[model samples]
Target: MLLQMKKKVLFILISVSFYCGLSQSREVDSLKLSLTNSKIHDTIKIKNCLILAGKYGGFSLDSLKKYTLDAIDLSKKNNDYLLDGGYYFMGVYYSEIGEINKAKESYKKALPLVDSISNKKKFGQILSAYANLLSETNELDEKIAYYTRALKIMESIGDQSKIAFTQYNISNVYRLTGVDTLAIDYLQRALISAEASGQKSLKGHILNNLTIFALKNKDLEKANTYLIESENICKETKLNLLCFHTFLQKGRYLDELKKTLEAENAFLTALKNAKKRGAPQDIMLAYTYLGKHYEEAGHAKKAIQNFEKAQEQDPANAERIMSPFSYMSWSRAERELGNYKKSNEYLLKHVKIMDSLNSEKNKKSLAIAEAKYQTVKKDKEIANQQLELKDKASEIQKKKTQNNYMLGTIVFLTIASILLVFLFKQRQKRKNQELLTLKREFQIKTLESLIEGEEKERFRIAKELHDGVNGDLSAIKYKLSSLLEMNNKVIKEAITMIDDSCKQVRAISHNLVPPSLEKFDLVEAADAYCANLNELNPSIEITFQHLGDVVDMSKKAEVNSFRIIQELVTNSLKHADASNINVQISNRNNLIQMTIEDDGKGFDKTNIESSGIGLSNVQSRIDYLQATVDLISNEAGTSYTIEINKETLNGN
Candidate 1:
């Protein structure tokens, strides 16, 4: 009942794009986890986006687009080179959804960015992708040529997985041109490549093609084996597109074995999965295969129904996804049912589409265009390499000429060069010394402000304890003594304890908020403090003297100045074992100078670091006052001459 069955056999049913690998859902989850929640737009995030864009495929086009656009935006933001990857993935997405024209445009944008095929695997994949687009308009020769180029790159790199994809595409083209022997041979080669690739999902797709070829050969046993193996792989990997084809192929196998009911059931299963896949091509394939099934069974009305459904797919997918066989089968069905007019109409339409697709003149033009494109690319590479070689020769010649002419000049400049380097080093050394001095000055200013605040806080706290809590302790002690009997031994001991506590508090308060330093100025304070120290320690004769006109200074300078003199004198009594210490203070031109001479054993200046906190405390106060000390120490005595520039005090 079929008209011209051998001549009207349409091209292969499956049009597989370049499937690099199966990107698992968990991998997508892992990449999303690596991305921070705060949305820092940086290079690290952009790289994650590019990798994630490549990771999304199959049915998750939405996520693929999301990360692709994210990568593009972030690459532009960071001035990076990842926009090419975005365009490449966009082409894949467009092609998958049956947007042939948009996919072509995206591939064109990506072509210039990819490196040469030998250097970058992405270049070969992009080439294969552009070739896939060529298949839509029946540019079969151009498609095969591009796939051959990509195949050579894959083979050179030993990427069996990529080799399998290219082989499968090339075989499909051979099948389209009705070269059955070569098509079958190429499919066998592709099968070997897929098995060597060891990608289980890819092997499954290749096996599906093998199942179709075996069925066409009417080798029922081979077809059964291939069908079972591929079906298992499809189910295991959950490759939706491959699974749909495997199911349709199984229906054909079942029909060959005369299991009519099971064969129809398999076709319906394919239809269900096709609808869920949401690709118009897969849906059309499912319906067309089902229609072919009923046509072979002599069910004219049922075949016509399925064929009509196949033609009613999305118009956007009409050019790329529609099959020529649907109209041919519909014409055959109408002719068998006494509808000559409708039959003629359907047959004419099918002939027109088939002629357009298999036109020899169009194929020649496309082949020439493809040849020109390849030639230009090769010519450009050759030109660039030649230019580089010519530039290198010129550069070498220029260098030789310069060396010959400047031989004497080079000898003359050597001595001058040495002198210039010596002077440069000297200048650098001077600059470094100046930097250290500036750093020291800044450090002194910071410590002066901080230590000055600390001193004031201590004075305030000492005053609070001396004026408030000491008064309360005396009042309590007196009240307790008056209310208790004086003759009781317990009462006497309690009062004695209270007296001891009060004395301790007063001693601490007096040491912190010293009476001389709190109430008198620096000169008066120094004289009074030394006189009180001599009274307290009668064995030591410590004298204090002052000279020069008093200069106005801030409270910080006054407090710190007195503290420095006090600390130096105290150090002589504690560590110096000084029996006779004399301290003198003089002021002139906003500069105050102090001299402390002790008749005690002087300490090693190197060992000053190991001395107690006494000298360090003095040094801190010295920095606060913007002062320096010159020490002349020996076994007989130690003398400190400290000078303070009152004008240098800041935030005093």
Candidate 2:
């Protein structure tokens, strides 16, 4: 069971990895198709369908707004419990481009959807995105709650990559709440999953988060390690935006280590790269870091100059223009300069911004509450509508029930007819098989009888030639020899002719049936055959190797073996055009094995069975002895192995 589970897991991993390896353009289309197919007129499909619609619509702000509204309309048209989830996506899209209120409003809309979502995976993604937005804006508790919900869903589905992302976001929530140890723990888990999955983008994202966590914990060594990893993965993947961000992190790590010169260089590099990319958030982040670095180096003028530059570049509604770190730096710088009024002014401005950010979050909470109330009210109305729908559904069901009985009767009759036909087919197949078996048996018997008769007739003729013809010629030779001593040239010529005729008759008989096998042994007969085969084809080489005991089998066995070998050697010479042929005979454990291997113009195994009769004849002989023959042929050569059971040996 454990092994089976491992196999299943490996299969799943391969499938997921294959999909993940597709290019971004392919993934978009695949995801779109998946989303389209997911629509089932049920709440789950409706939720996913709207999410997909919103995603496609989010190519630009104008398109995003248009698509998001369309999604909202669809969600309402479906009037699903998961309707709020679409609003969350809208909020995220709006917030991304600095529309905080719009973002909050959309997030509020998503809350009701989350409440009614039947699908865990869909709800989890929604919660995760919303949680991330909340964490970024400093709603720590709310962020943690949503992340937990998302993480649970991810765990359920075994989606390790998304689970890692959710954990990383959760860690950020912990970091926001000043829980550094827990944050580190979660981030480490996130890192493991990310690396295991080869999710380079997610890994870089997690590493960047880990860098911030390490910096917060004052673990400069740990911070640098993660920063280097993040930078390398980002650069290798050409994640330019991520690479741009990692520079600022590296600068912070250097500053933490008190390498002021190196830190300044890092900060400058980060600013230049971020400016080149024209990423406003990254540029603001770089300036924030550079300001702190300059302030720590005791360059108050440069510190103030960098801080003011960051504020100017920050978008008009940027809530966190003076980052928490920047505010700390600004406060210290003002106090050091003895400008009490300016110090208080900066402090007051920071407090005001923080207050406004908090107020925006509160407004979000109230909006969510209002949305929830509207959702509940809508749910009640839907419930009443469902009650009416149920009555209509009952009427439809009554009609369907009557239709079902008729359909079932037809189906039953159809199934019975199919069963009858199947049984008849089975009966016919059995009859056909029996007829085939009988025909094959009759064919085999007739062929065997013919072969036996032909072999017996050839043996008789060979005996006649060897005995009668050779004896008569020898007698004529002796008579001629006696007369040739008296200058009888005609007689001598006649004797010579008769002697040649006698020799020709002996050769003919030997060719008809191997003579050595009757007089000598298997090896001698094989040697003589090889010698004659080589004579016929001088270009072909034949090697014979015999091992272990050799037994002289019955005439029938010998004749069959000789015939098979003769055919094999003939075919090799005529068609194989082989350079070398090796015949190996081995007797081991009371079994006889013959192997014929040739370096020839080899044939393809696929084509061999259909191509000619040589293989068919070989197979037939092996089948007669209930032995096995395996022919392995390829482009390089051919190998044939025939194994006969020792127990079945005719003369054992």
Model 2, clash count?
Answer: 2
* Tens digit per residue, CA lDDT, model 2, 493-573: 898789769766875687677878778766677778787666656688988888888744666566666666666766776
Where is the poorest 10-residue window by lDDT in model 2? Answer: 1-10
TM-score of 2: 0.45
TM-score of 1: 0.50
Which segments of model 1 are wrong by more than 4 Å? 1-26, 30-36, 39-56, 60-67, 117-119, 135-145, 298-301, 315-321, 335-340, 354-652
Whole-model Cα lDDT of every candidate shown, in order? 0.72, 0.66
Candidate that would win on lDDT:
1
Best by TM-score: 1
Query: Candidate 1: deviation at residue 284, Å?
Result: 1.3
